[model samples]
Target: MTSISMAGTGSGLVLTASWQDTVPATLTVRAPGQGDGATPERPLVEVLTSRHGRDWAGPRYVATSVGQRLRYRSHELTSSGSWQTLSLTQTDAVTGLDVTSYLSIHDEHLAVRSWTSLYNNASEPVTLHAVSSLMFGDFGAADIDQMYLLRGRSDWLAEGRWSRERLRDAGLPDLTTPGRPFRTRGCIEASSLSSWPTAQELPTAVIGDDSTGTHWSFQIEHNGGWLWQVGEVPDGLYLALFGPTDEHHGWQLELLPGATFESVPVSLAIEGDGTLDAITGFRRASRAPGGGPGLPVVFNDYMNTVMGDPSADVLHPLIDAAADSGAEYFVIDAGWYADNGDWWDAVGEWQPSTRRFPGGIGEVLEHIRRRGMVPGLWLEPEVVGTNSPMALKLPDAAFLQRGGERVTEHGRYHLDFSSVQAVDHLNEVVDRLVNDLGVGYFKFDYNIRAGVGSDSVAASAGHGLLRHNLAYLAWIDSLRQRHPQLMLENCASGGMRQDFATVSRFDLQSTSDQEDLYAYAPIAASAPMLILPEQAANWAYPQPDMTDDAIAFTLCTAILGRLYLSGWLDKLSDDQRLMVAAAVRAHRELRDSIPHCLPFWPTGLPRWTDQWISLGLRDVGGDALYLTVWRRDTEPGQVDLTLPPAPDGMRWDYPSAVFPVESPLRIEGEPSGGTLRIVDVRGSHAARVVKLRSVPVE
Candidate 1:
């Protein structure tokens, strides 16, 4: 028996998934009003499992699961405002073990969040090999030529590097080839059981067809041990999302009778248009819930300026300057916890260094409070320095261990949040910092990865890491619950721990640790590809001696997102100070519209060394738009930006003083929309933020 149901997502998309006794179960999405009423034949969701007594499939670890052989049991549907959930249950014909998949959709963004659960319905215990958080059916037309896959790559300094590839060019053999059964090949994955999850790659991808404006984007929401795959199948391509699959990460689970295991969560967005639509859909769907503090301008003393060395004499002037410059939160990042100059290995104590502070850190905190800025501190909670007393005092279970030996990386031991002692220790540290010290913001930093993870008490190293990740999220939730006013920023040595799982919980995300303002341009321009603009805390660390063009360039980098000011603010000349202040004032004017606007790039994704780049945010109601353009080199520094169709005579304003243009400007109207012929009017390494207002056409 089989059943099919369709629901409109209110955003021009229709989601449909079906299950049948003879056919495999799957979920698919399509643009409504275009396709016939008949249900699409491909299922996007795939599930694979292993039973002790059954015949083996392909690989003990990576065998793909097709739902055709399973027995369809039942399903349920529930709805709330703009959101709906579809839960389906299927059982293995031979073992009676059941798998239930939950697919939740929100109409506001035409997006879906999915996860799976394994239930031991049988009388005996069952060992499971794998469960997927999400699996996607191929989108776009039958011909693969129009299909392209988008992937984001990241590193310590070079972050948010995105590239596009044609699906057929991926060289996957055609599944429709005669007598050739399709074989899945080569998967692009980003896995981090280690501390730096985004160090190598971002857990996000997009599939789009150029010929047809259809696109699909998905992101895995796990802080540790995540894997997503794109492979070719018989009818179309498929995407598989899981956390630490057994083949790569050595993960497995045992479910005793009546026991259950829930897979990690994944979110997917379906848009009827281009890459920008998909990206905007993701941002709207995965944003942090309301009740947190508003995103404000922050000043940190660690990037390119202070470099973590802070004392009373060093910080007092900076705090005064930051407060004067309109920074709302002043964060003293790193090196405040230890008196010793070499403070990396002396962490875990989290005590303010009296030697560094001299008059005590509280004096500085009081000064910041008096200056009308919130006080923030840097903390690395997941590690205990080898030299710290807690390393020796805590039980073996408190720290990550392989067999009986504790795992050490980069002069620190990874703390296992699954252990009560570890959680309690971190809780105490946070409570003390938030309560006793009157701290309102925290910049949480993670510096190292634990490699494959600890093998303490779990089925596998991957299993142990998964347990710890969940526990860590739970701890963070509890902290937020205890202190609802506290704002937490997630950083793994800067922008490495980026994912929806962490992004949804925290208030802000550090975009990068790159100190060079010139080199940081592409990173800031490309940030909206992965993070919400309001939550992307990009650093605007303009040095005192930098040229006006250079200063404007760096300030523009931070203004689009959460402005993170650093560098020597007190030493800036009057002219330089005015430029910085103008950037901040511009950001404040643009901040309110940021939460409701959708991001789009006029010239597409920025290259690492692109001479010209543009990022645009337009309101959904078509009333206004904010565009930032950066010119890196002295070459052609000109771009003709064509905005989405807007009312005629839209007002355009630019601050020529800050963003001096060397070229003449020409404005024209085209069939596509209004065109800004912004000619050679800017110095090299300069930028401008243009505000466009739409007035009713008379």
Candidate 2:
């Protein structure tokens, strides 16, 4: 009378575990296609695979009641010869409560991805019209956490900490519609509360909620090559099935065949410290050697290449300069492709510009290596210019076209990702660059979106984006699988694609190449809110008339965090480089050690004058917290800095600097309501990141 037992055989049993626990006493089976001649027997796809993979057999199921939830188990009724593995158990390892309904696990290409689906399934529809109820996560939590909400409708706060309502959208509009396509697709994940419980902390009970039905896709990033996703399914119970979307040959997501009303896949787990099913056979991940966090610097640093400068030496100085300045990456930009055009004759070409690289790209790379930096190259991957060679060589139907002309923008045309053949072609392109060239990084840009009247139109909104991004994922995963070491930065006209989905898929965000005129609020909010501050549009090549002070302030804003130094670092004086160097070093060292990052000093002001300012950072030790305060200009006002959370009974110190004088500010010794006040900060900029120290007592 063991808890675990197998039935008839292990063939249809997709997966099985080595027997251990007792299966439930009673087993219930249902049909997914209820009325139209479907059987009482489970559907052909319901067969469960033991966590051990093909080694064991399980049951296949179909929902008889459509949206009804049911449970089953193996016991006296269930035969003996059955084996079970802990990883795929549908039953509780300890009590065997038939947790299958709450979770689903399946094998797709040997890797098991979990999917979790929640449904109101009762009568009417509900509008999740609130901001707090969104899923927000970036590199650690980057994309729009709140499923693609109605563009200008509700608003969201930093990583969903505290949010107001949103009033506009950067994309097109249809304001009257319900939840826009692409909502929550992931089950609730472990809380991102900024504090790690322990090194081996297992998920006790992680979950996701969407009172308002948005898009049905969410992914919890595992490694660089894999993630979990929910497949298309009608709002139903037990119909929730999940399988790893498999990133082997190319990007793939389980697209539900319309006939079924059940969600094909859902996120679930059975064993271990709650990890994804053991992934196997992916030993081919590509590597770029000298594995590190990744290259975090400039892309296409060649102006001559852009301007048709034939001398490879043109890039020599720039690459060499970037290398010396601690820049980790340098991209060759546009002109390297062999071709002709206003945008670059090489638009359709994917080959190296041998003439431009007079000494060969190998020599240019060797130079960069000598200077101590990684090399990143740019590729539209999914875009091709109509006038380029690849376009002429490729058949007309190979691209996404409009009325007559090739529908495109940003000087390029879209690749028909819907074709497997197209994907294969791109794969070959990736292999040559990543494996053959030893290129360490890429700046993948999507300059145009697929407009109407294209055969490349996706079957589903989610699938459309899925296929579009899938191409890149496949290339990167293949590289990672083969190399297991490298970085891929995703860019779409700067911050255009700066959402969590894209961020989670890549390592960096371009955050727009334009000068951050409204840099204060967004970057200030974005630094700790999403991508690292260093990835923000930090440094820029100013126009001739821009003042030096503006550049200095911009530089200062950038230096305060993970700085991204673009523009002409060479054009600036030695003082500028030294200042940036010090800032970069300080940030690199203090990044993890500091708590919240502040991109801009707050505007000093009394209660209602303009607004109050508060910037605080908790030391990694949790005992110390540093706060920088700002007072509004002109108007005489007192601004308060409310202290952040801290461990109880920890002795803390308060220090302050006001208009040329540094002094000690009083610590009120409170939590939420605590405040630091400064009066009449006239002509005094709210610039401060001073230190405050304390050690927590055990």
Candidate 3:
């Protein structure tokens, strides 16, 4: 038998694999000083084909015939700067199929990205039903009962709602009875269907060892269908991540002789501290170069403002107020292109409305620029309204269709970016908007889900959808290349498409379409756990009718992340307007350090009905900490929060000063680790932002 181990230079993670002449290769990952170095019994790669099915009758992805027959062939290790990659090659002798699994990690990140490519070397065709992107056994040394599972659920108005449950409670039973060795057929699975990756269930999960405080977190980096499962096997607990499956998504591909197929990419992060640390590592590995663009304060005319029915007179004052309140970009949301108020179904022409903007839409965009802010427009670029002229003008092949008919949803037809006609048409629209109308930013929104997939020009409907998803990302890359200075925001009915696949590419992500300030607190606080704080655009729509405390509460929700300002700022009194300005100023002062700060939750993950929620951003140096806390309707005037160890001689202060009328904060216990007491004398429905700074003992 031969064994190989690779260690991350700075991450302190170890990957070990073992194989022999008659045994299949097995792989496992663990952090430093975690678990005994036992050889995993499960195979490194799992593949299900039409010819070879599962060896054991179960719903899990492991214990497949092809997976158990794959023997180790060769391995290679390569590195470039801080990044290192390890490729393991395995082959099934009977079927003449080869699998090359690639694992890449950064020296500074305790996360690993994994994927596999399959090549058919036989003479006949190979029908693939499912292929695992990543698989590993013996996740933690503790028993299954002592571990917990964490998952997130998201929707239109409610996004980033996370829940934690024990492994047994999450539907995975412990079948380790003495004398009788039986593996259960059930597993804990989280999956996303159709085009909206994050509409129903988020493609991220975490398994924590309650006794040891260790955590394992993972995320599927796909914009379409994805599935992840955790199940028990004879050897130990196993995890499998995949892009799509024949059973769940009807995704099957036939590989002809010498044909190759690559699986979707997935990431795994491990930490001994807690689940939040694992997530922080995962977020760091998923970031792009320079960690995205600057956090510019954006103001949109939607969500409690004009509510998508904007007119020249209505937008003129809002634009002026947004500029006066220190907004850097002003986006004219939906209905700007509608000739009438009924703009939902007649959208694809990309023309200014004559009735809504009698002076021309250009007038409002020019007004935005005159007030010293970049002009932006809201666009749903991936769909053509059924009643739109472009629906008839574009070729039938340019849109996604199944069974020879166009796929329609919510009065719109999904566009296939693989088609030249579709790309060319959107290219022209964007060029015209940028070159002719002087628009500098775009809020790209997607409002519909193209069911199953498109069967036009592909092996299956699921395959067709997967191809289009990749093409759409490539199109965005090309668009950025053409207009290098332009900023783009990704919005899918408000975060339905909030995945690393999109967040890593877009400048900002609209966290939600949630309109109520009171309910939006938890969503805003939980967003940084999934995406970078600099890229999370939380809306703070403080209206003139809201009280001073309520205005501060809404502003506090946005100050820690990308401040998205809205509401009727023009109608606000002088004091109210100043509060909004103060919030923007505070965000600007701290935005530069946001990209370098790691996120933590002092009060655990927020529940939908939780009265108190807190999110903290700690700097890399551990000297500065910015904490935002929200208190919903409750009888208690103060709440005690458990915080991480602070630097020696550190003191708490309110940095934003937006809530000067609120009570001061108090700390108890030792300076290293203590409880923070936050008092909101105004009581229920109030929020505050405080900073902890290190002071020299003079």
Q: Pick the winner on lDDT between candidates 2 and 3.
A: 3
| Residue 382 Cα positional deviation in candidate 1, in Å, after optimal superposition | 0.6
- The CA lDDT of each predicted structure is 0.75, 0.38, 0.84
Question: How displaced is residue 547 in candidate 1, in Å?
Answer: 1.0
Ranking by TM-score: 3, 1, 2
lDDT of 1: 0.75
Model 2 misplaced stretches (Cα beyond 4 Å): 1-291, 294-314, 338-341, 344-348, 354-357, 396-411, 435-437, 452-468, 517-521, 527-552, 559-561, 592-638, 651-673, 676-691, 696-698
Task: Specify the poorest-scoring 10-residue window by lDDT in model 2.
Answer: 129-138
Q: Give the alpha carbon lDDT tens digit for every residue of 514-595 in model 2.
A: 4442234233333333333334433333222334434433434443343455545555566555544554554454555432
Better of 1 and 3 by lDDT: 3
RMSD of each: 3.0, 14.4, 2.2
Tell me the tens digit of each residue's lDDT in model 3 across 1-698: 79777778877777777789898888777777786667778788899999998998777898899999999899998888788888999999877899999988777777788999999999999999899999977575667889888899998899999999999999877667899977578898989989999999989888888888878888898899899998877766888999988888878889898999999999888865653665565666666543226788999989798888989999999999999999999999999888677878888989888899898989888899999999999999999999999999998899999999999999999999988999999999999999999999999999999798999978889888888888898888898888878889999998899888877888889999999999999999999767888788999999989998789988999988889889999999999999899888888887888877888888888999888899888877556778888888656566677666555665533243334335333333333336676765544777888777655544
Q: How many clashes would you count in candidate 1?
A: 14
Report the C-alpha lDDT of model 1 over 1-698, residue by residue, as the tens digit: 36655464566656666777676576766656446344434443344545442132443222344344555678888888777888888777655568788988776666778898878888877666567787776364445667788888898889999888887675544446577675554444455545455677778878777786677788888888777777665565667788766666677777788998899988787765654665466566656563364668899999988887888899999999898888999999999988867987778979999998988899999999999999999999999988888888888899888988888988999999999999999989998998899999999988878777778888678788888888988988888788888878888877888877787788888988998887887888888877787888999987888987788778888877889899899999888887777778778866877877778877788888888788877777657777778777765446777666674555433222223232122223332345565555533567776667665454
TM-score between model 1 and native:
0.93
Cα lDDT for residue 317, candidate 1 = 95
The better-scoring model by TM-score among 2 and 3 is 3
Error of 2 at 302 (Å): 8.6
**Candidate 2: how many backbone clashes?**
78
lDDT, candidate 3, equals: 0.84
